[model samples]
Target: MLGGFGTLPGKLIWPTSVTTSPDGDLVVKDSGTGHIQIYSPDGDFKQRFPYGFEPIKGMGDVTCMRSGVILVTNGTRIIQLFSKDGELIHELKSPKLTWPYSYGITVMQSNKIAVSDWTDGGKINIIGVDWRMNAILKTNAIEGFHRPVRIAVSKNEDLLVTEGQLFGRFQGCCIKVIDKNRHLKRTIGPRYGKTFSFENPSGISVDSPGNIFVTDEDRNYIVMFNPDSSLSAVIVSEGLQGPSSLSVMEHGLLAVADCYNHCVKIFRYK
Candidate 1:
């Protein structure tokens, strides 16, 4: 079993993504600071990678691949690959990605990448890249999205997406589930108002048990749901200012990038 809320030193500035390395180290993308910070499981500072350039204006979102490589989205419809220690390994660019503002990225088991391009008519693209970040196989957008923010793949291979409303401000954003064939499975939430009871839903991750965890930035809480879209529980409701990205560690432990507070908070399942 995992315990809740461990203490850590150092601050993160405008952190956008949080991911755990295979070695149990917590990695984060600090957008404001233009750097990546690594932390031990116990919240000890390990190292920092400056990223060498501004990622927010150039890259929309960044994440660590399952194979331990880092993928960063370039606003110009390209993906940059970097070593875990912040070394520039390679880059992936395609003309198909114009006006790209990729806000989410996830690595599939097939070693391909599913990235969200948030543009006029938003799209989710699956791109195949080699070890050198070279493009292999590429697929077009499966569906037109309103404003896709974050993404998560279920154990059953289902793709889950959270949509953010462009107009109006309230909790009612919707979570859209799609099958492997890119077919829409169902829509969840949109319960509170036009926002679907989710205010600024950003980061999402799934546990080994097939439970889904979503960070409601405006609500300052992490919402958990079962595979059936039923409410399971609220994991962390306090000590968070703006939770952006989520990554699950071993033993049901969760790492959250609290953007506003400029710190990563770890929560354990009780």
Candidate 2:
């Protein structure tokens, strides 16, 4: 447990996302407060700052670029970049996006940024290193997205995006794997071993070996999938309430944004 309502420097309120800096520090984003917090590898609080103008809800995703710049989405058409110390760097917007409700975000090894736009059904837009639109993932009728939220990039640069309905019945609760050429490769969820079914697949992360980890906000646990897309294990189940986001940490550890619990949970996976 890293944060909660308290006198601590890094206290979190409704944290929705977590990522690691290149130097092995944890950077967390709280949607309830629109703030980001940094903590040392040993769970010591470092600093905190507001990532947006005001406390905004549904601002649910954050990622740290390899260059140490933090990129965050505020559920708007623009994405904000900030220094590790919480200083504003710049804002990224593509003219191609109209009324985009940005949600999930991830940066590839090639510096290509993948952001999920929730408007008009849902689609992932790939941004170039120069902050221009490179490609927007396209799907046919059979592969249309319902509501794509959190996303991850595999070792081969394939995107694994989680799609689910927000209101009403939860439909399209699965991870859609799309290749670099903007093609749907396959979907992973529902009836593999008949042991688990994803309700709301929110946060996603890929380990060094290309293993995928996902947080099921509704199911209240974390699940891991091998590179082969088979269920490797149900890694975390106890003491979780709406695990919204997760990131693979250094030295075989995992950090999860336990949303309902109002804290980040760390676990050793190896």
Candidate 3:
């Protein structure tokens, strides 16, 4: 466990997204407190970015680019970029993002930015490194996208998205896998029988080997998937509650934002 209630510096209230910096530091967003906490690779809290003057009310997923720039989705039409030292760089907005309430975000190996929007029928907007619109993915491209929340890009550029229900009863909880050519390849869970059904698939991440890791909030477990999208195992489920985000770190380390527990947990899955 990396953070919890204590006098320690790595305290978290409701950690939602966890990612790694270029230098191997862990960057976590505590949505409940609107604070972005930075921790060393060894799990020591280093610093936090406090947007106290302009609180981020709808903070979403956070990702770090190869250039060490951090991108954050704030549940609005725009995305925010910050320096490694937590200094705000600027906000990204475009007319192409008509009614965006951006959520899931990731930096592709090609340096493209993939962002999921929950408004106006749910879509994923791809932006270039120069911050220009590259493409937009929607149900027209695939049949299974309803409120896509989180996204992970595989080594081959395959996009794996988590479909989550924001409010009311849970309705369409599954992971939609789209190939590099924008074709729906597969849809996992929410229908994989009782054993593998996902109640609330929230966080998702891809390892160096192309294996997929997902966090089920309602089930309180982290499940692993093979490179071919086969179920490898339910790697975690003990003493967990409402795990939100997942990030595969270096040296076989996996970091999870245990939301209900108000902390981040690291595991050696390899």
Tell me the TM-score of each prediction against the true structure.
0.87, 0.91, 0.89
lDDT computed for candidate 3: 0.80
lDDT of 1 by residue, 1-270 (tens): 111222232466667788887778787777766676778888877777666454344235666776677877645566778787768777777676543677788877677778876676567787666655366565657657777877788877788887765555442377888888889998777663233377667788887788888898778889888878887777778888878788888987898888777777788874
Cα miss at 91, model 2 (Å)? 0.9
lDDT of each: 0.72, 0.80, 0.80
Task: In model 2, state the lDDT of residue 20.
Answer: 88
**Which pairs of residues collide in model 3?**
none
Per-residue CA lDDT of model 2 for 1-270, tens digit only, reads: 899854356777778889989989999887766678899999999999887642347555889887899988878877788989899888776576553677888888778778887677877777665643323333122236778888888878898998866785677789899987779888898545467888888888999898889888877878888988899998888889888888899889999998878899999989
Question: Which residue pairs does candidate 1 place in steric collision?
Answer: 171-197, 172-195, 172-196, 172-197, 172-198, 173-195, 173-196, 190-196
Q: What TM-score does structure 1 among the candidates reach?
A: 0.87
Candidate 2 versus the native: TM-score? 0.91
TM-score of 3: 0.89
The list of candidate 3 runs beyond 4 A from truth reads: 6-9, 51-59, 131-144
The numbered model that scores best in TM-score is 2
